[model samples]
Target: MNSTLQPTALTEHVPQPVTRTERVQTIDLIRGFALLGILMMNIPGFGFPYTRFPLIYGTPGSTDFYTAMGIDTAFSGTMRALFSMLFGAGMLLFMAKKEDLASGHSVVDFYYRRLLWLVLFGVINAYVLLWPGDILYAYGLCGLLLYPFRKLRPAYLLIGMMLCMILPVLRNIQNTVETKQKRTTYWEAVKAEEQKKKLTDEQKKAKEEWENQLKWTKFDTKKDAEIVRKMQLGYGQVFAKLMPRNSNIESRGMYYGFWDMLGMMFLGMALLKLGFFTNKLPTSTYWLTLGLGYSIGLLLGNIQFYDQVAYILDPGAYVDTHFFSVFDLYDLRRGATAIGHASLLLLVYRSGVVPWLMKALANVGQMAFTNYLMQSIICTLIFYGYGFGYYGKLAFHQLYYVVAGVWVFQILFSAVWLRYFRFGPFEWLWRSLTYWKRQPMRLQSEPVPAAPQTALF
Candidate 1:
C-alpha cells in the first residue's frame, strides 16, 4: 500500500480510456456550473436585500422577484443537484479505483478522513468568517452518512433517495395545512376577543405589539435603537416559537437533504459505472434528454411561479375565489426541479459542449472548497457589523450590484490563481493533510492520473 495514495489521486494501475472521451471535463463542467450557480441562492443570504432564508418568508421588490424568477429559479435550485450528482459520481469513481490501489484500507475509513476535513473547513468558514451560511457543514454531515450505503444496489439507492426527498415535502404540506387551520382558529379567537371588549389598555398594547412583532418586524426599524429592540424581541419570539421547530426541522431536514444529495451522488456513481458522464452515450440520446428535461422543468417552474404570485396577492381569499391554486407552490418543487436540472447538466456533459466555459468552471470547481469558504468570508466582511455593517441597509436592487462585483472577482481571481498553482490553496492543504504526505502541487513530468470517468446511463 502506498500510504501516500489519495482518494482523489490518479493511479497508474487505473484503467485508461480507449475511446476519445473526456470524463474529467464532464465532471468539471457540471461542477463548474454548480459552483457558479450556487451563488444565485447564496447571494441573497449574504445580505437582507435578496429573498430571506427559509425563502418565501420576507418582503422583496421587483428586482428581487425577477432575480427569483429568472436567475434564482432557473439555476439556484437545480445547480446544487448537479453538484451533488457529480459528487456521487466522483464517489463511485474513487471507490472503483481504490480497489486497484489500496486493499487493506476500508472505503469508510478513507471517506471519514475526507468528511472530517470538510467539516473542519466548514466550521472554520462558519465561525471565523462573517458569513454563517455554510453548505460545507451540511455537505460534510451528509457525506459521512452516505459511506455505509455505498455498496447498495443502484436501484435501491434511487428508491431510498426518492423517499428521502418526499419526506420534507410531505412534512411541509402537513405543516401548511395545519397552519392554515390554525390561522382560521386564530382569527376566530381575535373576533371573539374583540366582541367581548374586556381587555385592559396594557393588554391591548401588548397584543398589538405581539402582532406587529409577528407580521411587521421586517419593516419596523428606523433607528439603531429600534433595530436593537427589534432584534431582541424578534429573537426572543424566534427562540420561543421557532426553536422548538428548529430541532424538528434540523433532524428531518438533514435526513431529507442528505438522502436527496446521496441519491444524486449515488446515481452519479451508477452513471459513472455505466460511462454516462465519461461521454460514452450516443449524441442523439444526449440532446433528447436535454430537451425533455428542460421542457418539463420550464413548464413546472411556470406553474409554480403563478402559484406564488396568486398566494402573495390574496392568500386563502384569492385561492378560494379562483381555481388558480391547483398548481403546486414554488417551495414544493425542490426535488423534481433539482432532478430536472441534473438531467440537463448530464446532457451537456454527454455532448462535450461548451469547452472553454467548462475549463474555467473546472478551474473554479477544482478550487471549490476554497472558493466556497472565501465567499463566506468576503461577503460577511461586506455585510456584517464586525466588518462593513451593511447587512440590513442594502436594497434588493443594490444587492445585485454587490453580487456582480463578487462574481467578477471570484472568476478572475480563480483563473489567475490556477495559472501559477496546481490546486486552490486550500485544496492543496486538504490533500496534503489527508494523506499525511506531500502530493505534487503542479503538473509534474510524472504521469498524473486524470479524474476517473463516469458510465453512461
Candidate 2:
C-alpha cells in the first residue's frame, strides 16, 4: 500500500503547461498590448544606430518631433515594464498548483530548465538576429533568483521590490552629480585654454570625456554615413561591427539594468499575488490606480521629454537641466505609466464592448514568444544589409509604418494560428524541452473554449 501510494503521489504532481481553460484572459490581453506597444520603441533601434536615438529628424513641431515626443511621453518604458511584470506574474502562475508546489523538486527542475533555454534563445536573438537590446538573457538570469522568493507573502515581495529599487535610484542621482561636475570641468578647461595657461591633467581628461559624450549626441553627417555604411554591409561585416556593442550590452549594460529588471519582477510577483493581474481586485481600485498612475506618469514624462528636446536643440544651454531632471524619478515615472497602461487596458477588457478586439489581442498574447522573435526576424530583414538594406533611409517617424504593418500581421496570424494549434511554435518548443517529452500540437475536432470573462463590478 505504501509503495503504491508513493508512485501515485509523484505521478499526480507531474509538471505541464497551463491549458486553455486554466489561462487568465486578462493577463493575456495585457501582454498582447505590451507586445505590440514595444515595437513603437524598438523600431528606431532596428532602423538606426543607438547614437541616433532621441534625435529628432524633423524641424520643431514637425511630424517627426511630435511622434518622438508622443512615444517618449506614452510608450517608451511602459511597454517593457508591463512585459517584465507579466513575466514575473508568469513565474507565480507556473508554480501555482498545490500538487506541483508540494512535489517541489519536479517543479524546480522544470522551471530552471525553462529559464536556461530562454537564456540560450536570448543569445541567439542578440548574436544571430543582431538585436543588441534583447531582454531574454536578463530575464532568465533574474528569474533564477526569483525561485527562492516564490513563497514569500505579497507584503514581503513588495518590500523586496522597494529595496531592489534603491540602488538604481541612487545610481541615477550619482549620474546627475557626475554629469554636472564633468560639464563644469570642461568649461574650466576651455577658460584656462583661452587664458593661454597650460591644462591640468584633470581638466584635460574632463574636456575629453565631455567631447566624447557630445560626439554620440551631436549630429554629424560623416558619422551618420559611416554608421550606415557599416550597417549596410554583408552579414559577416555587420556581425563584426555589432559584436562590441552587443557584447557590452550583454555584459556591462546588463549589470546596470539588472536592478531595474529585478525590482520590476518583484513588483510583478507582488501585484499578481494581490490579484491585480487576474482582475480579482475591485473596479474602484483599478480606477484609482489608473488615475494616480497617469497623473504622476504623464506629468513626469512630459517634464523629461521637454528637457530631452531642450538639450537636443541646444546642448550647452540645457545640459544641466536635462541631466538633473531626466534621471531623477525616472523609474517612478516609467513604473507609474506601466501600471496606468495596464489599468486602462484591464478596464477596457472589463467593459466587454470591444470583445472582438479583446479576443484578437488575447490570441496575440498567447503567442507572445513567437511574435517577439518574429518581430526581430522581420525587422532585421527589412533594415539590415543582407536583406533590404534600408538602414538609415527612413526618418524616425516613418519607422512607425513598419510598426503598423507588423501589428496587423501579428494580430491576424496569432488569431488564426491559435484556432488550430495548442501552442505558438516557440512556446511549444520551450514546453517540450522543459517537460522532456513531445507535447500535443494540433487541436482536436472539439472546439477550443473561449477565454472566460471576469465578474463585472
What C-alpha RMSD separates each model from the true structure?
7.0, 5.5
Native-to-model Cα distance after best TM-score fit, residue 11 in candidate 2, in Å: 8.6
Q: Provide the lowest-lDDT 10-residue window in model 1.
A: 14-23
- Please name the candidate that would achieve the greatest lDDT relative to the true structure: 2
Q: lDDT for model 2, on a 0 to 1 scale?
A: 0.80
How close is every model to the real structure, measured as TM-score?
A: 0.76, 0.92
Q: Which stretches of candidate 2 lie over 4 Å from their true place?
A: 1-13, 51-58, 98-105, 320-323, 445-457
Error of 1 at 302 (Å): 3.1
